[model samples]
Target: MTTRMAAPMSVTTESLAPSRSTETACFHCGLPVPPDAPYAVVIDGRRQPMCCHGCEAVAEAIVAAGLTDFYHHRTTLSRRPEDLIPESLRGLELYDRPDLQKSFVRVDGEHTREAALILEGIVCAACVWLNERHVNALPGVLEFRVNYSTHRARLCWDERQI
Candidate 1:
């Protein structure tokens, strides 16, 4: 049986729009606006408070570049600067979940696990060697073997440090 997933809910422009009378947070990232923060960006014919010059610049860039649709359609607000992760790294985070890990990783012992991975973008022997060396250099990795012909790699790692 297939599980049905609900579509992501869209955020309304009104919810993200700044209420000048009582607004105390950055409209772009949802961070608390400092008491004397003078940063703001004009969007949808209204001024929106921003937490910092950084947010103001980014928001202004987005508006100037005609990317305001992101503001209206975002399901969740942006996080604080320190809490934010790079967009490229976010997709790799799914591998950390136990459910996803189960599919590729096999238990070898209490502290050891093995993973069969299919690597992409490999075109030559140097690429395979570079990948093998990089993965094997990790602290808890016990071994890394790769098949250049198939672009497949088997990795053994320690669970506690991995």
Candidate 2:
């Protein structure tokens, strides 16, 4: 039936939209990055692309210099922020006792004693943080610092707290 054949539909090809170029940020300077950048620094513990190794080295130098504000800001943009312990609690005691049944040996004054605690279940920074935090919260603690790499906490405390 060649009577009224419907005209053939013409198919049109749709072009794809261009993708947006990703902007790279420098780890140390917070500057715009290029595609061919080589070295990158850890910005707030996150890796970032850098223009060159010198720039990355400079950034690392800044971090090593104890200027962490920049890194902190950059890290906040992409990662969870860390909770730093209060400076007041940096050097504090948890507990100490001169005559306690189960306690570390003393080498100094009764009020000031050094104890090696066999910390159990300490594996990460969080564990160190928790143990140090709890230990420092004690009334008589004078100083407490944990060596996570060694899984131990070195504590100095006033005997009264025990």
Candidate 3:
């Protein structure tokens, strides 16, 4: 089965013409922000195109944390969206914690649980394929799916192997 979600909001433009592809530097990651990108965020008073929602969210978080100086001092393009996720947030094991699981997970059968996640670094169909492949290869993962349009994942797995 396929599911669809609403696209993210975009700032309006005066012209009704289709946007032409142009290579503009991403304000957050310093990579080439394609002309037709669907996600964008305002940073330091200017609106900038973000390659994906992950980049936009990360940029927003950085600016909100008052760490804007990192952009000025950085010498290279930003790391993969997955790598940019802070160490504190990488505790996947936390899902096993009862308190946390109560909020985002649902019990299916005796040994299985289902959950949804918003994945980062998924910018294309290839990314969706790779993520699904890698995650499905895990020991107890019974099902793994990635939605390229929304960058959302649906997963089912055995609690014991998790």
Residue-wise C-alpha lDDT for candidate 1, range 1-162, written one tens digit per residue: 995543433434345545565658687877678899999888767788888977897788888877777786687677666567778866897898889999999999888999999988899999888778867977899999889999899999998997
Off by over 4 Å in 3: 1-86, 90-92
Q: Among these predicted structures, which one has the highest lDDT?
A: 1
Cα error of candidate 2 at position 42, Å: 41
Winner of 1 and 2 under TM-score:
1
**Candidate 1: which stretches are off by over 4 Å?**
1-89
lDDT of 3 by residue, 1-162 (tens): 995433334422213223444556565655666678887777556686777776887788777776665554555567767886789889877677989988888999898999988888877898888678868978899999988888889999998998
Which has the better lDDT: candidate 1, or candidate 2? 1
Tens-digit per-residue lDDT, 109-151, candidate 2: 8567777766666767988886788678778888789988876
| Alpha-carbon shift of residue 91 in model 2 (angstroms) | 29
TM-score per candidate, in order? 0.46, 0.35, 0.45
What is the full ranking by TM-score, best candidate first?
A: 1, 3, 2
Q: What TM-score does prediction 3 earn?
A: 0.45
